[model samples]
Target: MVFFPLTHQIPIPNKDIISWIFDDPKYYQDEPMYIDAQTPSHSISLSQARILVKKLIAGFHSAGLQKGDCVCIHSFNDIHYPILVLGIIAAGGVFTGTNPSYTPFELTHHIQTADVRFVVTQPEMVGSVLEVAGTCKIGKERIWVFDVLGEEVPDGLRSWRSLLGVGERGWEGFDDEVMAGDVVAARLFSSGTTGFPKAVDISHRNLVAQHVLTQEINKKPWKQIRLFCLPMFHVAAVPIIHTSVLKAGAPAVIMLRFDLAQYLEATDRFAITEWYMVPPMVIAIVMSPLAKNYSLRSVRNVSIGAAPLSRESQRALKGLLDERAIVTHTLKTTIQRASVASYQIPKQNHKLIDDNGNEITTYDTPGERKPPSLFTTTPNQAPVYIRGPTVIKSYYKNAHATSQTLTPTSSLATGDIVYCSSTSQEWYHIDRKKELIKVRGFQVAPPEIESVLLSHPGILDAAVIGVKIRGEECPRAYVVRRPGRQWEALGEKEVRRWCEVRLARLGRF
Candidate 1:
């Protein structure tokens, strides 16, 4: 008999994201639901956000954008971002977030790949966005600015606030007719160790499944005043901040951009009860001398994800912060719709594969640590493969990529090497599949960088590899110049500048 892990019988909420965000009529719709820590007075209530979302929906519909259309947001995280995202999904449009740091060339690829119908951006980024818009043929009228800081709006573009319809004339309720199984709610770009970034199609079912799983695992009821600092475009930020945190009706501070000093000050100032950070932030906390000055005693829980945290770092972090603070390590994959697959294991959903490509299912002896390709023939060692409801349905518009990733039975090849204890049934991570590079908690594909380098006219043959610089992983490139070109002609600084202009921020070494 095949063994399967049983999950807690939690009630899974199957509906559009708006319903979950505004579920409880009495769920604390107070003055400060989302706050800008830099400017305290700039905050919005849940009621206010709801009204804005309704107006936003009416605006999009009036502007000729229909259900299933793609709307791209190119800006930093703030109170308005979540409202815009939920509003897009609420209006039945697919929401896509472009990295705020991307250049015109890099931004163009995302806009073209997603077939974005409209764009919402901040004033500072309008120049590059306009350059891409010209290339992609997106009309200037379709572009709008938001989160403006008294900056003069460009001549042809409109403000996000201006898109609002009068008195919510075309507004509907929080409810929508989208089904759980179909309709991609969010499209996230993940460079899976090779090629250009592929769009991960996260369905309504996947988001709801994640919400249910998080609710079961985190049984604590709204004690922590949380902070959202991670890039809104990444898989890690959306589920934790948008879905799970909102479901709990907890108050949160949304940072427009992450500054290390500001992060520390905010923790001390707001008496932040919970710290949700990636490994890079935790590493900074452990290493920085400034960490000693702050009063972080109010923090009761610390959660780290988007990359692995070593046992040594975990121990150091625990000692640095309150030793009593509960620090938890979470695993999130972009292909999994930002779901907690490792935490929500349903038993038969996981499998271990050896070097020889054999499935391990049983244990013959106790304490037998055989390094047979490190494959646990006895359910103890090897790479992990996972299948679950929260796993994405497919890579949007890429059937070939989808077929390669999803197995015959729909299990996602996680490419994470792991092991399971026979008696305890606890899964332990050993190493990654040697293809991905985690730079400051973001995935960097070697092939993606290699392709960029190859595109540079000065380069002929190039190979890229991940190098560990100061405890964090960074991509290092080795290049061969063209036949007639010398190393002096194409200097290292020039090549580096070439890469900086073309590659995305995370893709840079």
Candidate 2:
């Protein structure tokens, strides 16, 4: 992992980014937080969404959300946020949103991390927790909800309606009493390539500086046009769409998810100027029929991170998009919204050098080991530094993990091992720096899978690994059945049932 302070080398406190959004009163009109061609176009804008967010803060306050309180949000990118997060910072609460796909155990892990007293969820995800909450730590009564499928909130649950319209109530100052270097936003439960999943805390400064950095470094002028598939959840998105794009007053055509047809339609529909995509997303874009059918007249570039793209994908991408549109790599610090940095991949690193001609030797590598030159010393684990804008600060309430991942000086010890070409000094990334399994695209920390397996009555010791099937990969665990245990007597087809009951599709083999 590169040791330079990815965040502000000078530490700053965590605070709401609402000031960025609410600053311009004139532009605060209701627009579209979500624009989908799928239906009538479910939408919310900066103005109205924040209004509800403001109300939620009020309701939370009236119901008593003091400083340092943790409020969990579980929803996909609907038309509600840009403001929902703004309100969380404004309310003096730490907003921790969980992946909707989490099992009850994973959900509980984060709840305990943030000490979350209350939860806001959609109906479909409710059963996972409620079925197990009594045995867990979360306070079930504190859940307030949004209707799933437009249905009513379940009995004994609070509706999101009761939490809103705090506009009539005078706005209060932000919750969390933030200070420079203080923990601001919590994106809990990340599993580095080597360890168990833990929460990640991001500071306010970490969030903002990178937003500005993206604008400066990526050559993204607020005035230029931008077209992108939705990567709404990360903090990097904040700097661009929420901060730079919105502030630049540029029109951003959005996609509900990565769809080749939708992405192409969006470019043509909006005359998109740039593309912010992950590798897989780019791959899909390249393979999609739209790549040929649509003329991206205004499309300029495609920015990507996470796993590195092979030379083959890079060549194919430039050929598919306009050749002039550059394909660049994004290095985002691992956090809620990570700090994003960009670098061009060298067909051969030998050609590039610094002003001194000594060579810019900081290279990113393939797995958990640190790039040879980046580390001051050696490390205990592997790190996978992803590409993007906003990087994480620390793991939420996971001091050990935070300490394990983020050093006191602010070098995010990404467990990902990177490699720098000795000849050119440029960086190239490989896979996870650790033993974590990549079931689908998401990381499934091996230790976590092992722990769950051991917890089951049917299992004993277990080891998990990502096994390749045909050419694709999936997880296949190695097991040592309980001594003298009979699979037939258990009457089960598979002894891996423990993992089956707990892991999501992403974690399953």
Considering every candidate listed, which one attains the maximal lDDT? 1
- The collision pairs in model 1 are 5-347, 362-378, 376-381
Model 2 Cα lDDT, one tens digit per residue, 225-250: 56645545543465555444444445
Error of 1 at 21 (Å): 2.4
- Superposed Cα RMSD, model 1: 10.2
Off by more than 4 A, model 1: 1-3, 169-178, 338-348, 355-357, 363-380, 435-509
TM-score, every prediction: 0.80, 0.66
**Residue-pair clashes per candidate, as listed?**
3, 49
Question: For residues 422-494, what per-residue lDDT tens digits would candidate 1 score against the true structure?
Answer: 5544555544666667677555656557767866766756777888888988889999786563554887888
User: Which number leads on TM-score?
Assistant: 1
